[model samples]
Target: MTVETIGWNTAQRRGFGELIARSWSDAGLRLRYEREPAEVLAEYDIHLAAGTTAPALPPSPGELVVETFNAAEAVPPPPCMLSICFCLQPDVKR
Candidate 1:
């Protein structure tokens, strides 16, 4: 898996959310959030899998796990912004 960090911004956040929704719809998977975005600098974790077509919701069990293992060495986002982790699958040859 590959990890990427997106800077917090109004436009970026909207675009990112839309992209995630589309991806989940196309993949027949549900998007699960770890928590609600109710803070000024809220952080959310979106977990996706390769099965089921139920409505998007929070993780239940045996779902994807997203973590910031190297958060100490990472740069924090600007204040009054949101941050999310996007885990992408590795490219493979047929």
Candidate 2:
């Protein structure tokens, strides 16, 4: 199984979330928060039985990556019904 992760800057979080929530649905993805880059790790239903997989943790130094254990496969999370994430920021109200 393979998972997807997305990292957004602190200032870009609201804008990005709003845009996604506005167009995305309830995806089965999980959000793993990390400091510094402020990242969100999204796992997919995809798997890698015979091939090599990537890791999705601690990420990497200078750069981030998908941490995959030997038996750990990534699965795509449920897709959101909405086109984006409803950002409830004080400055961003629909």
Candidate 3:
């Protein structure tokens, strides 16, 4: 599969980290993200390309990583999928 990760600048990454923390504590924000992930991301000035599907958040907060997979061009892999993993944690012991 062809995997592409969005190039996030330092500022964008920082914003995303903050967004993650907020969403973890706010139920409403999490609900909005589930329904309209793109809209929620836009608030942080993170926009996906046209025709790109916004990924859903993990069951629980941990880290923030977004990866897109294109299966049309690549062989194998039944269905294409977007992966959003990891969470922004502040010095929590593993």
Candidate 4:
């Protein structure tokens, strides 16, 4: 699992997830959002524990989280962010 973690740093962008999303997108990686990494990894983006779950699914065994106090939740939201996990499904393998 090529997991990447960006720790908390004032210089770092707020909202771990929001930054991750933008980074992934910039890398040309298609992603979706969910609350469970295990389940969402198979379909959408990474799962956020403190995040909301639409169609809930059991979280994965090992989870990676990037915590930050400067989250983009401040008014006027700083571009937003979220964690994303993904698994290459059979269809995608082809």
Which residue pairs collide, candidate 1?
Answer: none
TM-score of each: 0.24, 0.21, 0.52, 0.17
- Candidate 1 lDDT, 1-94, residue by residue in tens: 1122323455445434544533444443232222322211122233323342212332333333444344457577423222444433324211
Q: Model 3 Cα displacement at 77 (Å)? A: 47
RMSD in Å for candidate 2, one decimal? 18.2
**Which runs of model 4 end up more than 4 angstroms from their true locations?**
1-14, 28-94
Put down candidate 3 lDDT per residue, 1-94, tens digits, no spaces: 1113566677766666666666766789889888887888888787877877765554554543344445476576544233433334445431
Query: Which residue ranges in model 2 land beyond 4 Å of their true spot?
Result: 1-7, 25-85, 88-94
1 or 2, which is superior by TM-score? 1
Tens-digit per-residue lDDT, 1-94, candidate 4: 1123322343222233333443343333223333333453333333434453333222432434434433356676444243443322224330
Q: Which candidate wins on TM-score? A: 3
For the record, the alpha-carbon RMSD of candidate 3 to the native fold, in angstroms, is: 12.9
Q: Where is model 3 more than 4 Å wrong at Cα? A: 1-4, 59-94
Question: How does model 3 score by TM-score?
Answer: 0.52
Residue pairs clashing, model 4: 15-71, 15-72, 17-81, 17-82, 18-80, 18-81, 18-82, 32-45, 46-84, 46-85
lDDT, model 3: 0.61
Ranked by lDDT, the better of candidates 3 and 4 is 3
Worst 10 residues of 3 by lDDT: 78-87
